[model samples]
Target: MTDMNNPDNGGHGEWPQQQRPQYPRQPQYPQQPQAPQGYPQHAQYPPRQPGQQQPPYGYPVDDAAATTVLPPVPAFDDADATTLLPPVPPLGDAETTALLPPVVPGAVPGAPPAAPRHRQPVQPPFQQPAQQPVQPVGHPQGYPQAPLPEGQPEGRPRARARHAAPAPQPAEVFDPPTMTLKRPPAPGPAGPVGAPPVPPFAAVPAQPAPPAPPAAPRGRTGSPIIEPGLQPALITAGAAALLAGGAALGQVALALVVALLQLLTAAGWFRLNGMWPARQGILLAALAGFTADAAVLLADSDGGVAAVVGTLGGFFLLVLVLQTFRPSDPKERFYALTVLGSATVVTALCTTLLVADWVPAGVGAVALATVLAAAPLPGPKQLGPVLGLVAAVALGLLVGAPVALGALAGLGALVGRRVAAYDWPSRFVHMTAGVALPLAVAAPLIWMATDLLA
Candidate 1:
């Protein structure tokens, strides 16, 4: 008997090659006889008893008087195996989201799938590949590199490079989250690219020193004591003196003009004293008339110049002595003594010479020139003095003074001009200079020349 559980029939697992299926499609055996209960399902046909005869291997079996009609088997051929498989059925409608069934391997289970089939890597439900975290993209140098997350493959060089360095951020100045870019140096040879240079500092120029302050007022350290309308009152007195003296004195109105000039001098001094009380003494001018009359008398005598010089020195010394003894506070005694004393002496000398006809018929020229010298004309300040000198020269020549003498006298105003420009104790510090200098210097020379000519 042949046993199914023994796999080969009659103890043979496979038939010899010539005795195997002769066609391309191997025929499936008819349903095998199943053993009873749990004996075995697949089994070969039961053994024949006694001396039964075996059928030949290639012969076909047919049973006479069979009830069922069977489909005829096609004759076997030995060409390509295309006709071996059953025809494929038409595809039916299916949902798009449905997952396709995995293709089961036939004989060779260990081999890779064929080209037309998919072969996904099998992994356990618990061990699914870890999803990578997203990273920001940036320049390679901009950000620092960190270790990659777990489970990522080593092949992603580009991803690693991108993740290693994040994008650059804008720098802030006032906030100072990062250092701001240094400012570019000024355009110069001192600085070069990549290396910054120190900048040069400019020197601020020094301002000029301020001018000295004007003279301070004096007299009890209180308000200035000038009377209201003093200038007008003095001018009216002077005009009256002129009219009265003109009638009383004889010849060419000498007393009238002298009185008027003296009154003018007093008024000028009074105004100046009020302007700067600390520096001038109006009292000295009251004594001027007395000295002036005596000087005129001495000039008519032989030794007049010595007498004049002595009188002037004595008056100057007396002023200094008075300053030492009286001791007035808030008063600039040095300035008062020097300016007042010099001015009074100079005024006396000028008046005496004017009254005494010392210049030999040149009074009109001298007087006009002196007035012009002090006049406030426009253009250069020097223009006033220069025009005055030229006028003196021309007028003196016309008035019978010699050209040499007139020219010498005209140059005298140059000294006066220098004094006029000085910053003096008072505005009238130049009173002596502007009024007395030209006449005092020129008159003496004119007198000598006239005497020599005579």
Candidate 2:
């Protein structure tokens, strides 16, 4: 195909065409052109494909295929203009030979004439001057310098000088005199012999002092405590007693146990649940006592009296607890009421289930809902009706239904006096009713168990 980028093809060629002198085509020959001597035509070749050996001529057969030319190319100096030109690869050996001067196979232009190399002049070997015989100087009498060889360097050959370093003048010794000497000698026939003339140059070579003795080790003496597991053993023993049903003795025993538990929890023996574990202890003890009393009642018909005594003691204890510790704050009041009331309700329900065979299971649910709904009524003045309702419920659980109704009416009349203020006396009615309610229910079961047991 014709190259369109050519500028030498005249206007007919889409560029300025070079003035032409067309020549006849050369005849094809079988022989290849020869290269000059001592110069390689093509020895370096790129890596070949596997299983394909290189041509002996060091180039691909496609060299002849790249010979097509359209026209003289337009020269471009700028990189942007060069984009219009067709690409050309670097020259091969044959192409490179065409660009250089024709080689002449003859002698080199700058070779020197051949001859044998000249030898350097030699000098005689180094010789030392004769050494005069050495005389011993500053050496001790018996020692002498050894004879030197002819080529050896001269020096005052070292005599073995002992480097004794003056025996490091022993550190100055200061010995104090324990006693003084008498100044005058006794007078004799020679008149004391001139006081035993002292020496003019006496040297008292200083002597080293004795080293100090090492100190004795200090002694430690005290009575050692041998107890390893004492605390844990004590705790285990106490825990055994607590878990062994000692709570049934009386309220005093119950109170002490509960108090000990609170103190231990406070002291971090166990985690403290809250300000007081009274509520939890009360509930636990109540459930335990109720369960025991119920089991006894079921097993022995005559065990009512013991149950009654125990139940009365426990219920009275819970009442005394509630009354003695008045609420110190609003939250304390709320919590006290919630805990005490819930425990009392649980105890009451347990007693009801044990004693009253006629109570439907739905009674507990109905009773709980009524108590919760009634507790939050508006003013203290209205507490009379609340107390009356509470007394009614209490009497209903203990006495019969008719007497309970009478008690509710009676409570309303009693609490109606001095209702607006914080009436401690009036509040007592509600408190005492709440206290009496649970015990009234429990006392019967206890009495029944006692009678059977007796």
Candidate 3:
């Protein structure tokens, strides 16, 4: 390689042929990877030396060729140039005039002759009338007139007279004449002034007394005291109470009865609230009841009531938490919580009977009361509740329980019946809640009463 800056090169900076270094021929590999099909193959360029400067890939290397001037393009002439667009059709004078191009003074040589002007016959100039003509009397001008009557002539004098009459004017308002009302003079020994005298004992034909208006048929008042299906409800209640009293002999047996009552309470409560198909709520409530019963059984006798109450509170919190996870609107969540919480409480109440010692006597009183209340005795509606209370007291005396215990049990049973009957309970309600609720309700009362009496 020769030095590019060497003066002996005559400032041309060219590499001399004799001084160029010999390089070894590159060894060809056996195979070169071919480019994949459809791809453009790039030319392999020889590697350049660090000192060599090359022109850009697309440009000519010679300086004179790069600077050569290109031929001048011919000036565009409108007349000779051909266009891709279709020829313009000839324009009418109106269209041409609308274009507003500079106007030539004379007629265009090749243009179509101007359409001959047909001067419309000159309309006589409208002259002002000496006097404005009067419009006809009846019909105004411009607006369409109504057709003349069938029998009337177009120029009848009578019809003309009718139209000519002045339209009646509206009456003026005036103060009405004022008069004072006076009471008639009463009949006396002198009688009315200038009236004929009547005999003292003369019988005037008695005017028939105005027939009294038929008294409005009185609408039926108040809900029926005895709900329908009371008979079946009474039988079911009595049977449940009897079974509960018998189950009192064994703790396990009583637990079973209580469990059954809990199930009925859950199912019936859901139905009562019109929340059918609330499988989750029903299962949750039933599970809570079972847990309460277990708690009661595991607890010491003294702690049984506390166990039930605590179980109730814990399950209520669980219900609230579970409801939070429910994918429901706030209204539906709130409604579910209310129905489920109430059902849990009522089911838990059944556990009280297991802890109470006077359960048999209390249950007996409940049965007696429910049976008496259901009887269709001939008396006022009050008689049923009255008889129920008396029967409960009598039952208590026979069973050797305190009078207050029996009364409390009886009252609780009646209340539970009322609850079951509310909102027009169906037959299913009568069978399930009507039977189970009486005992469930009485349980708490019996437990409390026994505690107090003890």
- Number of the predicted model whose TM-score against the real structure is largest: 3
Per-model TM values vs. the true structure: 0.36, 0.20, 0.50
Q: Model 3: per-residue lDDT, tens digit, 1-454? A: 6566554433334556876444455688785588999997655545655555555344566755444444347798654564543444333333333434332222444569766555454443333333332323443343344455678765332224222322222222222232212222223334553244333445657688998999999875676433535665566565666556556568778888778778988898888777888898899999999999999889987899889999999999999898888899999998988999999888888888788877778888887777777777898976987899788878777888876888898998888877887776677777777777777788889888888765
Error of 3 at 334 (Å): 1.5
In TM-score terms, candidate 2 sits at 0.20
Off by over 4 Å in 2: 1-275, 278-284, 300-302, 310-353, 357-380, 383-402, 405-454
Which digits, one per residue and each the tens of the lDDT, describe model 1 over residues 181-285?
Answer: 223232233334334433243555778999989878754544332221223323323333343344355423653354344544444443444434533355565
Task: List runs of model 1 lying over 4 Å from the truth.
Answer: 1-256, 259-263, 266-280, 298-300, 328-331, 354-360, 370-384, 402-405, 412-454
2 or 3, greater by lDDT: 3
Indicate the residue-level lDDT of 190 in model 2: 32
Model 3 weakest 10-residue run by lDDT = 174-183
Best by lDDT: 3
* Worst 10 contiguous positions by lDDT, candidate 2: 163-172
* Number of colliding residue pairs in each model: 0, 25, 0
Poorest stretch of ten by lDDT in candidate 1? 89-98
Cα deviation of 145 in candidate 3 (Å)?
40
